[model samples]
Target: MSETTHTAATTRASGPGRLLVAVYALFAVAATGRSTVQILTRFEEAPLAYSLSALAAAVYIAATVALARSGHTSRRVALAACTFELVGVVAVGLFTLLVPEAFPDDTVWSLFGIGYGFVPLVLPVLGLLWLGRSHPRTPDAASSAPPSHRG
Candidate 1:
């Protein structure tokens, strides 16, 4: 493989990205555990909230693996994960604020991740920024693409 491809293949799980991946991994585990216990025990209490927690757990797991994975495909997957997370957290956070009665219990995105010190709110932003820096673009993509001169 070419050097550029090698560089492109370098994972976001490197250097500071390693820390990001670690945080993602931690959230994955925590969310999985929380969701599993909640669903297995009292899913009837607040199905929506518990289900959202389960969804968050899945998202976190996907993000963790995507960030840790190599190649452009993984980066794209990570990008999608981050975008979903950003939207989910924002929408859920706002929903909780506007309709407090809707939740009846907290999900990972409740109050902008207040239960998790807002990490859920900030993580996707950071992930997007990291993706911008780490994700590979082909020569035909981005500003690196050849500019056309229209006569």
Candidate 2:
């Protein structure tokens, strides 16, 4: 007889999350590659933008792994990364638009990810939703417990 052990190790990345992971992983690779080339060859041209790209790449990489791992700690990491990604994209987008001079060169989030079909701008939103839905409800913590008799 085969034995099956059920645990919180299972992740949402199996279903629709599979698509999410694919997207995040793709962005991670793309951003990492882009930032590395920009920073290595032309750091003086746009240090801020290149650095931001590197940060975004790191966040994407973290989020991808966390979401795919699908555990308590992993979920928290994914949530934080998604939140930061959203904030970064919005902040960078606004800054680039409000003052074009602020960014000497384009980062992954420039123009709200216009260069990447806006996937970068929208990915975090989906990730957050997936994380929320993936949250594990304790099996014996709340509803399963007997109701306490109130005085």
Q: Local distance difference test, per candidate?
A: 0.89, 0.87
lDDT of 1: 0.89
- Candidate 1 wrongly placed segments (more than 4 Å): 137-151
Instruction: Write one digit per residue (lDDT tens) for candidate 2, span 1-151.
Output: 1111123335576778888999999999999999999999999998999999999999999999988884567878999999999999999999999999978999999989988998888999999988777666556677778999999
Off by over 4 Å in 2: 1-11, 139-142, 146-151
lDDT, candidate 1, 33-78, per-residue tens:
9999999999998899999999999999999998888866788898
TM-score for predicted model 2 compared with the true structure = 0.87
Each prediction's total of clashing residue pairs, residues at least 3 apart in sequence or on different chains, is 0, 0
Clashing pairs in 1: none
RMSD of each: 3.7, 3.8
Native RMSD of candidate 2 (Å): 3.8
lDDT, residue 59, candidate 1:
93
